[model samples]
Every structure is written in structure tokens, then in C-alpha cells.
Target: MYLVLIAWIYVAFMMAIAEATSPVGSLLGAAFTFLLYGLLPMSVVGYIMGTPARRRAIKAKEAAEREQALAANGIQNAGGDDASVAPNAHGEASGHTIAPERKQP
Candidate 1:
């Protein structure tokens, strides 16, 4: 991806040089050509292509933070199989449930 961007920038720089050296082209035109065609489009493309890597980095950071919090709480192997996880220590239903009512005879 970066290789393609570098090649495009090189091509644009050459085009800008030609435009600036042309008798009918102004330096302002060359500058605008470089900015609009070369830098602007490539920068946008780079940002778009980098989105997946950014997301992966964010996920890794969050996982590391979670592991650190678990370690601080003296928990280990939190990601292991279900048997490693303990059941609710309180040994009670967590919320109230309504008992079924009997129909009137």
C-alpha cells in the first residue's frame, strides 16, 4: 500500500515539475496540482487502508487492560475453560421470580 502511495507521489512530483517548467504553466498551478492530486488523495487512502490495523490495536489494548485489572484482583487464568470459572458464591437466585398462580375452581 505504502509502495503504491510512494510511486504515485513520485509521479505527481514529476508532473508538478513539468507543469512548473512549462512556459504556459504557473508555479501556483504546479503547487495546486501536487496538493490536490498527490498529497490529498494518498493521505485519505492511507487513512482508509489503516482502519483495520487501528481497530486491532484498540482491541489488543483493551484486552491488555482487562488482563491487568484481573491480575490486580488476584484472578488468574480467567480466559481458560468454563471449569476454571467459579459458580456464584452467594448460592442464590440473583433476581426475584413470580410463582405461578392456581386457577380458581
Candidate 2:
């Protein structure tokens, strides 16, 4: 896919170079060749080729959001703020807990 795009760019670059070198063709003609043959088609093709990847990313993001929604629903249905909390070093319940300190014998 990318190889084709690269080839197109190379062709355009060469076309522009050719136009610039030719006695009959001006810098404007070179610019026209580069734009018409290279940038325009390549831009369109790149966007078209990129559609599938864009779609896949969107779908994956939706799936993630759906999973999050389901998980949130489950947590709400379960009805426990306590469940979100972890037991502390002293066995106290908190949002986050510290590791217990080990006493040396």
C-alpha cells in the first residue's frame, strides 16, 4: 500500500524535475506537474486507503466504552462503596491501602 504511494510521489517528483529542466516548461509548469500528478492523487488515495484503519479504531473504542458501561452497571447494581476500598495495613478499609510492616523478631 505504502509502496504505491511512495512510487506515486517519486513519479511526481521526477515529473516536476523534468518540467523544471525543460527549456519549454517554466517553474509554474513544474509546480503544476507536481501538484496535479503527485500531491492531489496521493492525498485522495491515502485517505481512501486509511478508511479501514480509521473504522477499526472507532469500533475498538466503542467496544471499550461498552465494556466500561457494562462494568459500571455491574458495580452500581452490586451496591457497595466498601467493595472499591482496599484493606489497610492495620486492616482498616480505605480507597487505597499501605502494605503491612513486618516486625523483626
Candidate 3:
């Protein structure tokens, strides 16, 4: 039982680092996994139930910022029509086309 507990703690620490480095929902996974593996049975239940909500709250905040940027740029919806002009194939704008290189005799 003691060895099992120690193993769980080690796994939790690794999961925490993995979660911290990932862009989405990683921290939640790490938190829940750690709680389930390390906490007492009662605490495990509460952590499992609560962690997703916390993660969603964070996601919601990020979504709001994205929405604000889109609105400022006059975009109707998320990822629908991108109003921002893209650069040309050679990575220059229409007005700033690069002149072709001429061979020097």
C-alpha cells in the first residue's frame, strides 16, 4: 500500500508537468489524476466532480478574449470568414511586389 501510494505521487508529479505544458485541458487531467490517485476516497470524488468545471471556466475566459478580438476586427463568427488580408504567395502585399532579379552581364 505504501509503495502504491508513492508510485501514485510520482505519477501525479509527472502528470502535473505534462498538464502544465499542454495547451488544453492538460492541467485538469493532471489535477484529477493526482487527486484520484493521491487523495483519500472522499476527496477523490469531490476533486473529480469539480475539476472539469474549473477547467471550463478557464476555457470560457479565453473564448471571451477571442470573441472580443474577432468583434473588433468585424468578424461575424468564430473562424467563419477571415477579414484580415493574407499576404501574397511571395510573402509580399499587392502594393509591395518584389521585382524580379535581373542577371548581370
Q: What TM-score would candidate 3 get against the native?
A: 0.32
Which regions of candidate 2 deviate over 4 angstroms?
75-105
TM-score of each: 0.78, 0.68, 0.32
Give the winner by lDDT: 1
Off by over 4 Å in 1: 78-93, 97-105
Locate the minimum summed-lDDT window of 10 residues in model 1.
81-90
Candidate 1 residue 16 Cα shift, in angstroms, is 0.7
Deviation in Å, model 3, residue 40 alpha carbon: 7.1
Put down candidate 3 lDDT per residue, 1-105, tens digits, no spaces.
346556667776777777767787577787876676556553555567678888999998987887797678665463454444433435555763677899999
> What is the per-residue lDDT of model 1 for residues 1-105, given as tens digits with 9 covering 90 to 100?
899899999999999999999999999999999999899999999999999999999998987887787678676765564253545546787666887799999
Q: In candidate 2, how many clashes are counted?
A: 0
Ranking by lDDT: 1, 2, 3
Report the C-alpha lDDT of model 2 over 1-105, residue by residue, as the tens digit.
899999999999999999999999899999999999999999999999999999999998986775587577553324433244322435666665878899999
Question: lDDT (CA) for every model shown?
Answer: 0.85, 0.82, 0.66
Off by over 4 Å in 3: 1-44, 78-105
TM-score of 2: 0.68
Error of 2 at 6 (Å): 0.7
Query: Where is the poorest 10-residue window by lDDT in model 2?
Result: 80-89
